[model samples]
Target chain A: MKLLELRGLAASVDEKQILNGIDLTVNAGEVHAIMGPNGSGKSTLSNILGGRDGYTVTEGEIELMGAPVNGMSVEERALTGLFLGFQHPIEIPGVTNMEFLKVAIDSHRISLGEEEMNTRDFMVQVRDISKRLELSTEFLKRFVNVGFSGGEKKRNEILQLMLLQPRLAFLDETDSGLDVDALQVVARGINEFRSDENGVVLVTHYQRLLNYVNVDFVHIMINGTIVKSGDAQLAHEVETHGYTGLGEA
Target chain B: MAVPQPANTLQGDLLKRVLAHEVQETPWLDRSASKSLLNCNGFPFPWKGRWQYSDFRALVEDALSLEGAHNALQSSHDVDVRRFDQPETEAQTMEFGSSDGVGDFPLIDINGVLFRSGTKLSSIAKTGSVKVNDANGSVDRHLMSIEQDAGMTVEETFKTGNRVVLCHVRDNAKLEYELTMPHGEGIGYHCLVVWLAKGSTFELHLASKGAQVRRNDVIVNVLGENATATLSGGWFVDGSDHLDSQVYMNHRVGGSHSEQSFHGVVDDRARSVFSGFIHIDRNASATEAHLTNRNIALSTQARAHAQPELEIYTDDVICSHGATTGHLDDDSLFLLRSRGIGEESARAMLTKGFLRQVVHSEGGTSLLNL
Candidate 1:
């Protein structure tokens, strides 16, 4: 099943074109890696797809599960199986991780016409996921990402990923600023989340994260458009040759 | 403990409750020393000092309309005064006057000017707790001194009108004061003045819910050495409500430490103002003071103003201050929304989190729900 399709997608911020004429498709059970240098607009694609403010889509079509996402709000898109793991997770003091997680899950339940998860069952599920992510149970009681180390913040994002469980997930720089250990944990989460029923759009600055997570396709983006598309080995070529003049039409 | 002074007496005719007119002697209006406050035809410049963000004239106008004397202060005082250790004479009798370090604020004069009744209590207790509840919009004046080596706790819950609390923590004494203003349709104001003597300690907890307009002025003066003071406040306002929380901590001697922290949330078209001031005298050398105010504005139309002022004359003192006023963090909002939470519910949860932080700052349970 096709999870996401972006055909000739173009977007801009402050009236300046950012994602210009981009095209991509992700089917269920496939993981696509998007790599680029600074200002290549890798994050812009994720932001536009995620329905963030300040970005105007100049031209394109975004569909999740064969439905147009043109007029959907951010939360609506999320409920429709669109999730973007932020590169810079926000620090919200006083909002405990447990509360945030429960509320997020309950929101989905309410939207899907399902019963809200009880506290005991929710705690059990969260504790299991947090344990898998090497997060202490006490972490659930603390404010979301407040005073958390860089590694901890990354892992917490993964924890959210596993719990929220979007059908098509866009991991935007999820591996940036993470140590070797934290990167492996994030890779583990991606591997655990990947299935024949879900898809992944991994955007990163380096090929370091691609080493751990297997990729079905690799696309090198530049000037707000993908200039190179190839198999998994293409990542090695870019790592070795650099992106100096890779955009050869 | 022999409680001698009747509850209705004040030094002389000064604290008496009387109407101000040509018919009778208005002994209560003492306009000699605090004339700057009493004789003000209108508030100073509306945009001056603490009144910068909030217009004093508007607050005064609306608060006056809500003023009424119904059910004069539903109060219940539980004074557990142990044996007065010192001879009754040694318990210093301090008179209420302008010389006692209270700044001449116009709001204080407005409170003293219009009030159906004025209740005065001069208590010297070792360990006592007093709880006063005021649903009626009435003004109250209370003077209490924690005798040397004594301790006292005061909890007040009120709505509308004004409340003036004059407290003195004598040498080696402690004072814990807490004030809660529930959500109300009227206005509310509280003016708290605390004086700490040598080796004394003082703590103030102020929690206010939404109101039409509210102002709290808690000033603590550390005159003695080896004293410690802590003040924490929380407030939440929504709709067209407005709140102004002002705090001032002064260190006169050395070897004293003081801290002031305030957290609040403003939603809808509400406006919240916070002003924290810390001053260290020239002789207050080893004095340490810190002030921090954190606020979250939930709506684009909502406004928050935070002013942190510090004046340190001594070289050995350590003073720090920080104030922030911003809308609900976008990053947090995005994270929540991207997880399938609706925009409204996510904002509400984030707002609740912010309020809970403010309430639990003083280690109190979170009784507020959004």
Candidate 2:
């Protein structure tokens, strides 16, 4: 069954149309890569899917698990298993990473009517995930993303994704600012989070991240709409040839 | 001979009468105190007093509509002092006003210390001492002044009308003070007098959550040698509230330290003003002082003004002050939004982050109440 679907979706920002018409669908456990140059409306599409503000969808429809997510808040969508790993993670001063994570966890659990996780269980889980993501325990004690190196912030997002275990994850240039080692760790974190019950859409300008996370399909987006769709090999082709010839096909 | 207009004469008489009345109220007020009050009254309307450029006085006076008295106090009068020790309703003494539907907690004992939260009323002063807790706590025996002096902690909260009165800190003592006032109905007056004794240490924290019209006047006196004072404040002014804070710190002796940092975010039609002065007296050598005020205007109509002034009379002193007023950083906003956080959520997060500094600085469960 299709776990996520976008049909005839159109979106715009500041009264300027960005996503003219978009149509796509993804089943459970599928990894899809969206490749386009800057201003191809790639970021706009990802943002609209996550219900970002300033973008109006003048036409079309979007459904997650057969439920329309357009009216849901960012937190509501997050609780419903949608995750957006930002290209530039926010630096929240004074609030420690551990504190934010616990709040997010408790928020979701409370919504689900589950018992709040005690400190012992929370710390044990945080330690386990930190080891998998190669994050220092000291990092959790510091304020969220404050004064962190570029790679560290990106890895922190993945760590959150792994812990939250969202249903559909949107990776927005998660590969940017990451070294090969960091990229592998990020990919490993994503792989660990991925299961038959979840899916991912990787939005990137480069095909390097695709090398680590095998893509079930690749979609080319341009001028606010999907121009072409193909297998994982298409990512390598675009990486070499760029946007040329692909438009002709 | 041309006669002065009755209106002008009435205004002058009113001002003189106010000064005269206040002087009578505080018989202990020294020569300097009397001169400061007169100077504040003589300060020309909309001219160069501490509130010269701020619309605080007009806004508050119009909102509260003072009739018989410029100051009023509301006391339950039953005076249940025993309730100061427990967290239960049986122990609750006062309820100032509603707070986000989270009813205010009454006076409680923390580690044998007695503290009651600030009420939402103006022109009132209530006093109690930690001296009562001396048996169970190690508090300073000499720190019993109604106003902050050296060697004590003062926690007071209130909602007010148009004026805040005197606060005094004594010489050569260590002091810590906290003020938390969230927005509520009506206008207020906050007249404060802080006196610091020779060789004393002091720290103050002030936070404003949501108040429609708030005007505060503060005077701090730092006397004697080796004295230290630090003041920090934060305000998240939203809705249509207007807030004003004016502080005057006097360095009367040598070898003193005074530091102040005030920050705020004003949204909607809200406005905020912060003016701080650091005065170093003659012969007050080796005096070190710093004052900083920063603000973020969140809306097109939202406005803020920050002024940090330094008056130095000694060549051996090190004093610096700065003020900045602007909106949130656009680049930072873009950075957060790029991460898939909606623009609105991103803005809210950053605003909350800015205020979190004040909350986290306290470094305790006390912030949970905030």
Question: Whose DockQ is greatest here?
Answer: 1
Clashing pairs in 1: none
DockQ of 2: 0.14
Q: Which stretches of candidate 1 lie over 4 Å from their true place?
A: B1-101, B106-128, B148-151, B299-303, B361-367
Off by over 4 Å in 2: A113-115, B1-8, B18-49, B52-202, B208-215, B218-229, B236-243, B249-259, B265-272, B277-352, B360-368
Q: What is the lDDT of residue B284 in candidate 2?
A: 90
The DockQ values of the predictions, listed in order, are 0.78, 0.14
lDDT of each: 0.77, 0.65
True-vs-predicted CA distance for residue B109, candidate 1, Å: 6.2
| Model 2 lDDT at residue B161 | 36
